[model samples]
Target: MARQETQCVIHHSKLTSYCNVCGEFVCNLCKQSKYGKHEGHHYMTVTEKTNELKEEISEYQKMITDKSLKPLRENIHEHYLVKSRLDSNCDELTSEVEKREKHFIKEIQRASQKLKNIINGHRLEFSPGLASRIAQLEDKKREIDSLMKTCENVINTGNTYEILEFSKTKKSDLNTTHSSPRQVPKLELHTPRSGSLVGDSFGNIRKSRAIFTDEIKVLKSWSYDMYIENMFTRNDCVWISKTGFFVSVKPKTAEEVERKLCPVHPSGFIVTTSGEIIYSVSNEHCIYKITPALTVRLKHSYPYLPCGLCLAINGGFYVTMHKHGADGKIVHYFNEECADWLEIMCYRKGVSLLKKPIKIVENGNRDLWVVDAASESVIAMNSAGKFKFEYTGSRTCFEPIGICTDSRYNVLISDFGHKMIDILLQDGRFLTSIKLQPLGISRPMGLCVTKDGHLCVGQGNGCVHVLRY
Candidate 1:
């Protein structure tokens, strides 16, 4: 190809040289600095500059041919591929929505048909007149209304993540449900054998109670060597076995369980929001974190033994530990590049709070539930660690040990003395008890409410019982 001649825009003159001072194209006339602010400017002859431009243009064309063009074409094609794949997935999602809608409609229709059959039977046993029939119709109407309300609550109130996460449990329920009218087991509060009027330190008794089942099905059990200390369950059940090894029924992502040495009996563990297991070792005065990759390392070490720990949604770590002298204190720590234990909040010893804090848990509202051993009470405090109310349990919480909160923010305390797990309201009211007598859950040591809403109770024995309410 013929080389195009360059022109200087300012003078409208043929660019016969390169100006070094101004770093721009200039004709020979503009090269004199004293004449036009290009005083004594360095200039290259037109043939030398033309040769340099020709070399640069040659290199640029070679780059486009050999390197840049193929990748640019591939990037353009990749956009098309991604768009096509996303459209296909959108179609699949629409199909899934249709399937879900049909399934719910069929179930609703079947339930309405059952109600119709019941009404027809009631018509045959026509002993009661219009007034009684009207009452029965009103009851049926209420039942239908309640069903609609429950369904709406699940759909509307539940977060997108929780609804998707509970899909597995919902599918299991759907599988068990049939056209036959299934009888739901009635949940009732059993009167304690002592028949004593039970009240907590706060004086607020339970307005609503928890239900327990006599039949405890041990889904899986194993023989362990020592006390099964604490169990955490999310997608699977995790516990430090008696042998000091972490055992899980469903291995998360098939990662090998790392036998990272913690305290022989670690005080407690919090499965972090990121799925890492952070355990507090009372003996070592250290906290260790185990990653999903099965890598265990010392995450943080403290001066005093960290007896219990709870993690907030914002990744703040609240710990209850054994202080050297009187009672242990609650320490709020933030784990950034390192574990920075910000400061000790409440460290006083009185009949009211902070005496040998054994176990600790945080509720939905960030209230701290510290099970104090010496005081024999669960000292609940607000987010600021201010004294809210001390719950000495319904029957003075017998040897309260492990503490955990459910999805509803109800606190579960394992009473070793009473051989029961006492459920309490977050505000320190006594809710109900799970008497471990018949279910073989004696010595309920470690208590945790699973993400799937199952209560995993670790016993003095090696076995951990997973119970549903």
Candidate 2:
């Protein structure tokens, strides 16, 4: 074989100008075409530029490596901290579960001991008839034990045939026992033990009779004219004075035929806190604040038709608007001049604040409670309008038109349709419903709980009913 000739690597070189700073090649003609001002600019050959670029790249990589380690160190530290907190929480939960399990086991043991005592007491009264029943029960127990043992063996050994056979036998035995109705013994039923009753002597009886106090006297009823007449009737909203008195208002049309103005028509009567007669009014869109001297003052004008009003914990009054908005429109106003006012009413997600807001009351926590007649739900929100929870009213046309909270945080919602009241816990748990007697509450509008815990509800019959729990 002929010896292979060595081939030399030939490198191409041309008159190319390279930028000294950026290492880009430029033809000699382009470099020569530069103006007089740029002729002195630093330029280099391709080989020199390449070597300079390699040195700069190595330095740049070192700089990048120095900067990248900081975030990596912080991330590792954060991961360790999170892992430690998770481990601590897991240990705490495990301990809590174990403690609960121990308590549950002790409770089960106590129950078992109590049951054993009951069984032993029954055995002590066993006669010949009971002995025959016990023998039958023992035979049934033995049969059940044998069936259970077979089932366990089949399950452990994964034997389908044996499992099917045992299941069929058990089913047949159950069917036979179920077909034969067993006769139970008619033993004397034991009466539950009661504490000893104490008898009162003649003198004690007389002393108890003497403890009767003075009876409450009823107040005389007053006649009041219907101040609201010939107007589109909206609702009746009422408010009590600081000294526990009643004041009501409703809407009435203006006499001017061209100008159909809806004004507040006042009812001229008031009631005392002790179920005594006071005065009343039939006004519209205006809040009547009663004085101690029985004089009514128009505190503020309601933007829309007002249905209910209640005093908040901050002394600010909350009034519900009964006006129907256009379809798909929901707007809430804090005051009558909402259009001119800068501050807008707050609202939360998933809550339609303006949908038939009828009754507004403040709870012990100073949170506002609203009864939406359209939605048939009672909604509770914080002062800042953050939604807390909602209690759905009954489905049977029990429209909740009045709502109030007692001192114990028990919510009382008045259903105008059902002519009754539903009580609920603060957490929206249903407690019970109270049905009003004589069933003529045309519309239960407003509710208030007195300082003595007496619930006072306003009905459409121009009367307020008081109930004591």
Candidate 3:
């Protein structure tokens, strides 16, 4: 057979140059050269174009394989991270749940033990009456034990259905029946005023003793020449001497007067151990320090309203405020220059101010005793405002207006409406009510127990009455 003649055919419609080595088209003589169109070209017939394309696609199969693997690797890594986070969260939740379960189980066991003790005590006291009830109680106890077991099983299995069934059964068995009547034992008793124990030590008793009676003594009443004007009672006012008193008038003015103290409105007053009179004027919003020679010396101001005043053991005084809903604050003035004093903001740690704190007095133990007039209670706290105890006033008609403490640590509370002075122990126990002999005390406002145990009370009648115990 003769060799077929190879011809070059140009397919211009396809926009492709053909090599003629395999009987395809050649546009120019340069196409025949090995370095030109013939270089690395696999010549093919015109009908083999589709087969050549199929061969070219085989080379790109590996690239497609690599592209498909990228998403699968990324998805696997993301799944691993998510599963790790989920496992950590589940472990934390399981730990918390186990701790809570242990605590609740301990609490329930303690409650069960207490109930058993109570039942045993009842059986010992009334064996005949409790014998029948003890059998029923045992059955209840067994039921509770079974329910607890079910709850434990449910917790271990984490089964909501089992927990719900246990809860329903417990509610039906434990809550449907009425418990037996129990006799509550008495704790304390009181004696009558006949100096005899009237009942068994479990009844309320009235004792023939006085609360603030020891602090009531008569003082020498010497009428001064000064007419009684409007006196502003503050916590810091002090009697400088027998004739001179000092008080603060305003933020800028402090006055010390002889023969008579000026009528400056004050919220509280106190006498220093050295006989200096210091007064806190709430309306003026200032604390004034006065001398014996009728001279104004030191004055200090505060941002809040001032009410109760008491001198601390360190010569610095504490002033309680009347600001409603506000925590009581105490400002301490240490030095004579008024520059070194420290104001402590102690609202959370101390005796909280109730409605309106009216008076404050320091006891021998250095504890601060405050009288809340609005709440009608006497509250006791340490120097730093730590709550100690409280004495509630008489509920029927007693209103504690003025308060003072004696050297013997007795608290004297003056009631304006009842016109009687209630004596209370340092622990807030009621001692006795001292009825005024001269009866017409319209409103008793101020009170002070003298060194000789005389109760000097300031009445609304423009006169201070001295009461003897």
The candidate scoring highest on lDDT is 1
- Which structure is stronger by TM-score: 1 or 3? 1
Candidate 2 error regions (>4 Å): 1-307, 322-353, 438-443
Evaluated against the true structure, the overall lDDT of model 3 is: 0.57
Q: What is the lDDT of candidate 2?
A: 0.51
Can you rank all candidates by TM-score, best first?
1, 3, 2
Q: Give the higher-lDDT candidate: 2 or 3.
A: 3
**Of the candidates numbered 1 and 2, which has the greater TM-score value?**
1
Candidate 1 overall lDDT versus native: 0.66
Best candidate, TM-score? 1
> Which lDDT values do the candidates have, in the order given?
0.66, 0.51, 0.57
Which regions in candidate 3 have their CA more than 4 angstroms from the true location? Answer: 1-206, 210-263, 292-299, 335-351, 437-440
Q: Model 3 over residues 217-334: C-alpha lDDT tens digits?
A: 4332322233222133234331322124332221111233333374565566665565566666777767676566763635546456766666666656667665645655555555
lDDT of 1 at 48: 87
Candidate 3 structure, TM-score to reference? 0.46
TM-score of each: 0.50, 0.37, 0.46
| Angstrom error at residue 255, model 2 | 36
Ranking by lDDT: 1, 3, 2
